[model samples]
Target: MEPPVNTIKLSQTAKDQLLKLRRHTKIDQWNILCRWGFCRSLAEASIPSPVPIPADSNVELTWKVFGGEMSDILILALKQRCHNDKLGTDKETLAHQFRLHLHRGIGYLAGDPNIKKIEDLIAIATKK
Candidate 1:
């Protein structure tokens, strides 16, 4: 399946947040942290606000790089989430929503005071 976006360009703010997350969690790959952020936003009940996020950072990841082996599943999840939100699954909509969720999740993760290590990330995943 084709990804919603070929290249995911992060905002300057997102780059900063990811840098902070890297320092705390010791996760070196941007793609891995971005995947976590995307899924984290997906887990939320509300839709991310459609704010403009400038692609001002140097960080860029191909869809394949970002999703790794789970590219198809991630696309499916994104499509399903769009459907659940009553948003059409067009390329534009998917791309827009993807950015929104990714940025929001990064912000959420970076802002959380409890995320001090990789174990904290696991703890979040295991939490009910």
Candidate 2:
């Protein structure tokens, strides 16, 4: 069935979580990719293996452990995988991974104790 038109509506709690996620994503992107040390480590670690790699492995684990940008490393891995015609996987894997990251990030933000009363404040902050 088609989705509802009013689906754009979100509870204040959800809105706050999203705002936090966006900020977190942006920070991670900059601090990890823009930093010389982190960027070099990530690029060095992103090289494909001599043998075939699995489709769903934590592509950024090595780089992440080395202070590389986790998000950037993951994106590069996914893009490489997506471009390989020999791989049997489809775009569904990419979509699912994106959704999983979003869910985890939002949950993390919601569970932060420092964000008390964030549920109500989120909507106000997110309205643009």
Distance from true location, Cα of 46 in model 2, Å:
22
**Which residue pairs does candidate 2 place in steric collision?**
none
10 residues in a row with least lDDT, candidate 2: 1-10
* 10-121 per-residue lDDT for model 1 (tens digits): 9999999999999999999999999999999999999999999999999999999999999999999999999999999999999999999999999999999999999999
Error of 2 at 28 (Å): 14
Residue 43 displacement (Å), model 1: 0.2
Best by TM-score: 1
TM-score of each: 0.99, 0.29
lDDT of each: 0.97, 0.36
How close to the true structure is residue 15 of candidate 2, measured as C-alpha lDDT? Answer: 46
Clashes of each: 0, 0
Best by lDDT: 1
- The pairs that clash in candidate 1 are none
